[model samples]
Target: MRLFFKKRSTFKLFLKLTDWNNLLNSLTQNVIGIINSTKDSFTGDGVFENKERLGFLLKTAEEKEIKILDVGGVSTKPGFKEVRYEQELKRFNFFISNYFGKFKLSVDTMNYEIARHALENNFEIVNDVSGFNDLKMIQLIVEKAPKIILVHRHPNSSDIQEKMNYKDVVKEVRDHLEEKIENLISHGVDKSRISIDPGLGFGKSMEDSQKLFDNLEYFSFGFPLVVGYSKKKFAQNLEMTHEELYDHCIKSGVSLVRLHIAS
Candidate 1:
């Protein structure tokens, strides 16, 4: 399988590959854009709940040639309200059909039913925030879509401040991901098709988050790294502005940075 990258004005075009394993091993920088589909997103850009606004955003992303668009219907931030499956499915389908149907789509969900539905609708990736706690969801991915992203998370924890306890932030996160990777491999998921995320603000405190970012090299884990630190509470309190944060992310060797600000 061969992958080609072309620059067309502001958009970048990524040609599909017949062999996904080879493509994943290739050293290439890919930019993934996130669409905040919930009103309670930590980022202030929750106004995108409007379909028209979402359409415009999608058009702009296509024009810019983003490699992937991750649509997240549920907000996993601290103190987030529990969103029902019905509501999530409604938003999920709407965003997929209206904005992401023609592009490479990734659904940000931990529910088995939701992930299965998204995969059935041609979504190429799954962003599981629960770190594959749902055995059924893991089985579905292994049996159906072998390529999926497994994020590290502290199960049964909701508050960010409470989940920051770690003997060694970098080592613990890496080991946790390695364990998950081995589990997936044992279950028949291809190692080349897997991606790992450190989950910066998911359940970490400001200090732990800083340590994770500082020790990013230690947690490379032989897979693509995705760091999502856009507009998080830690950034909001920092002396730097959003633009500065974006520049910081770019310099941090983060393969993909999920941002809420307009690019």
Candidate 2:
């Protein structure tokens, strides 16, 4: 199904297409299927570089009736070097030209340019792992006010690195996320266009990541949360399957999830 989002004088007008209330009403019992459209995702599910046809994968996910589709162009796994801008846009544009209009789509990118392109070309949301650091990124969201998934991570580090140091992991996370949220609002972004992701594997240690999941309720901050723990080292240590962990997040009030498998 195609989504219709029109920009108007008001920010709330653009939110009409987020399937926003669907996220709210399904918080207790649903999953947002993720499709890593990149070449080298951490979980080995990326389809962009495989010999298989991308259409087959997209068709399969649609057949499964997945509610939302999130596509990322670059691997966020630690130590994966940054993708050049041209290459990133090439992957994103390929998928956008073919499959975006057919799903409740989210484009995952940290780059302002890619996000801007997606926003203009009808992608319904931006899953921003960089916390909207760029002024243009902030302006795009504030002006166009599309849905966004704000992931929590420090600005000082890359996507993958040594375990970050945090004195009080839970408190620090709340402080950091709150600051970013407030910053976006101060710069004119509507809070309703925002969703929170604790970013389990981005830069946190096993313990810190676990603590955030344990206290996931604390960061709700009146916004829907998108939780992802699949293939995480900390979750591996506990031996919980992806579904088990997702069920737990749902029970703990998670509104959406990012996954390696869209089906």
Candidate 3:
């Protein structure tokens, strides 16, 4: 709630248009492939069966040359049943023990227990749609020292809340991220280990998400920027393929792009 940057402004960093692997600590932007382990995702990729799905995750990452793989144990979309901590960790542990050291890993979960477990198994990033709202999550992240992605959400009508309200969408999102970043730093988390996601299609409407995508540079927050524009309903609304939207984002200075499948 406390705005960190009084005089807000966008941060600029140049990356080779064709060579985006160097954008995030020299990691390629080929893709941050999404491998959902849940049973019911709105996008239709969730797999409850572990052995087969883990194989899919590994094979997809390997074949596509995707450097970062984001494994979501629980369904994060609205109207889905909640996944118990036990179930969530089970999927994550199996994946972490097998493929952790082989590649960079991010777990899309908001539960502190699951996050702590993933970090123990050498997971490097936490992509929390709740914007890391839990104090316990913040504590674990501070102690474990993995990258944290705080996604913007406006508390909403569904089980997933995106309660965002603002006249200037970009400025509001930027202010919110900066405020959260300052709070994390004050609580002993390293500034360099923080990143922000605009939470496309989460709390924001299609228009708000588009504004955030267009103004990606404004919310860099001096940390890595992750653009998640793949398979979203908003892309469908605009009558543009996810790949088409993805290219537009990269041109606007997206360093890391999270996708349902690697392009």
Candidate 4:
């Protein structure tokens, strides 16, 4: 399947060469998947030196018919070190070229250059944790691709506990997501192809994260909602095993989950 983005005077056009309607029709239930790469990725899923393990995980996901497989080289966890563009590109190229088409691919990156590379390699989606902090990333997606996932996060913030200063957590997250949606629409990203994620542990206290989840329905923004709470500190607090946490996230209306374990 191939997707094309064409820009005209006013609105942009998204052209698909495959039967997208059929594909969507086939996906009747919400999906259960995993985000399989990280560098101190909060949940300890980052395996920079273990490329073979990453490939094995992708193989297992394919065998299980997982709906989405998010591959990210950079860790967005608090106080994470920034990765150079060249290094990210190399890692992305290696992963995609070796494991492309194993499953639906969503590249987790905030850098426009990395996003562009993922799209050029036929990745189906771009997961930006910075909530569109980089304008070039937005422009590339608007001009070259239609499907993208915008996750809310403050670029200047660090730890989740320290970033909790919202008057109303739910309202604040909803408003920020609304702003992102408007920005994408203005820049020509098809509203139909956009999704919203309220960065679960990105910069929210455990209590704040709970409030956001409790009020998730209020911030749907007329788009599909994705929640990434797999193996997070909050989930771990439940004292459940990895498998239990995965199942819990699936049952909690999470469209896609970011998991460290393959199960």
**Considering every candidate listed, which one attains the maximal lDDT?**
2
Give TM per candidate. 0.81, 0.84, 0.83, 0.79
lDDT of 3 by residue, 25-112 (tens): 4444445778787667777766556566667657766665567778888876755677788888877766655553267778889899
True-structure Cα RMSD, model 3:
7.7
> Superposing all C-alpha atoms, what RMSD in Å does each candidate have to the true structure?
6.0, 6.8, 7.7, 8.2
Better of 1 and 2 by lDDT: 2
Clash list (residue pairs), candidate 4: 38-46
Q: Candidate 2 on 151-262: residue-level lDDT in tens? A: 8877666444456898898888888888888898899987777888888877888888888888887876677778887667888887666556766776676667665443
All models: lDDT? Answer: 0.68, 0.71, 0.69, 0.64
Give per-candidate clash totals: 2, 1, 9, 1
lDDT of 4 at 130: 79
**Candidate 1, lDDT over the whole model:** 0.68
How does candidate 2 score on lDDT? 0.71
Instruction: Give lDDT tens digits, candidate 4, residues 88-185.
Output: 87667667656644466788887888888888877788888878877798788878764667888753555322475777878878888888788888
lDDT of 1 by residue, 1-93 (tens): 111223312212132323333433332334567787777776555533588778767776766566577878888777777789999887777
- Cα lDDT of candidate 4 equals 0.64
**Decoy 4 TM-score against native:** 0.79
